[model samples]
Target: MPTPGSTQRKFRLADDALWAEYDQACRDINGSTDRSDDIRKHVEAVVAEWKQRHKMN
Candidate 1:
């Protein structure tokens, strides 16, 4: 079995992956068109959601 610290690290990595995916999606969407205020707001929302999930603040 994994140690408690390792379990926490795994959870953190999963959260990081979620953020990375969101960033990649933002880049992909931005690449297909011009950056708009709505897109920026969407990215901010995604980041906020990730931070909340990870208890980062």
Candidate 2:
């Protein structure tokens, strides 16, 4: 659903809560850009950190 003359892409998540969690982490990491997401490695790492914070063990 790209708009004309726009380079942005869109994504859909199954839940808003998951997106909220990722958004918080993204801010902490200064966010992915220039293709730095690299297979979502950074996202996964931050999610691990969030789990640790919540004592999700």
Candidate 3:
């Protein structure tokens, strides 16, 4: 998966309510408490789809 040596990243939410909503959505889709890997996978999927649709490499 991704060569196994990826750099960690940090992101800030708009506010506490937004952060809570995002966290709950992740948890709901994951069906478990742990979201460490799910978040990355979801973000990657979103970025890939966006780039493909926009013809951006």
Candidate 4:
């Protein structure tokens, strides 16, 4: 039998690989770059693009 939050846990596990890739890419790019400001700007741009495409914000 499953508990109330079991479905949410299963859903998250299914997408774990996707989230891992996103985090890894971000870390790699940020690591190769020396400027914190540039990293912040790039992350903001990516978030904005995702939001626009998904109509999230």
Candidate 5:
């Protein structure tokens, strides 16, 4: 679990291409604002969807 504002320090991307794509997606969705927050929200949505699909939560 990560506390608020700790995401940037905790999450890391090893692949430059993946990071670039993620950054571009974030910018496309958020218009160059709150990229980190958008990424966090995107990750949370994916997790939530996965959990719901798996009936884990």
Candidate 6:
């Protein structure tokens, strides 16, 4: 078994290629370039946009 903080953290995806694509695409967001952080920022932005759209209804 892997020990704590002994591996590169990554999000689970349907396929390894998809994860690689996402990892490669992450450049920088609000000064953090980490892939996991990038994914979190993306999800946050999406949810924010969704809330804005729903509020208009």
The TM-score leader among the candidates is: 6
lDDT of each: 0.62, 0.65, 0.75, 0.63, 0.76, 0.70
Residue ranges of candidate 2 with Cα displaced over 4 Å: 1-4, 31-57
Q: Please report how far candidate 5 places residue 26 from its true position, in Å.
A: 1.1
Q: Give per-residue CA lDDT, model 3, range 1-57, as digits (tens).
A: 344788767666669987677678878987764556777788999999999989964
Query: Any idea what lDDT model 3 has?
Result: 0.75
Kindly list the per-residue Cα lDDT of model 2 for residues 1-57, writing each as its tens digit.
446997874456789887766667666666543333543576889898999989965
TM-score winner between 3 and 5, please give it.
3
Give the alpha carbon lDDT tens digit for every residue of 1-57 in model 5.
457876435666799998888778778877885666876687999998998989963
User: Clash totals for all models, in order?
Assistant: 0, 0, 0, 0, 0, 0
Clashes of 5: 0
Find the candidate with the highest lDDT and give its number. Answer: 5
Write the residue-wise lDDT of candidate 4 on 15-54 in tens digits.
8787667667766877643344455587899998998989
Residue 23, model 2: Cα distance from true site in angstroms? 0.5
Candidate 6: 10-residue stretch with minimal lDDT: 24-33
Candidate 3 versus the native: TM-score? Answer: 0.49
- Model 1 lDDT per residue over 20-48, tens place: 67667767976533334445576899999
Q: 1 or 3, which is superior by lDDT?
A: 3
Expressed as tens digits, the lDDT of each residue in 12-49 for candidate 6 is 57898976766566643344347666766779999999
> Where does candidate 1 stray beyond 4 Å?
1-35
Which should have the higher TM-score, number 3 or number 6? 6
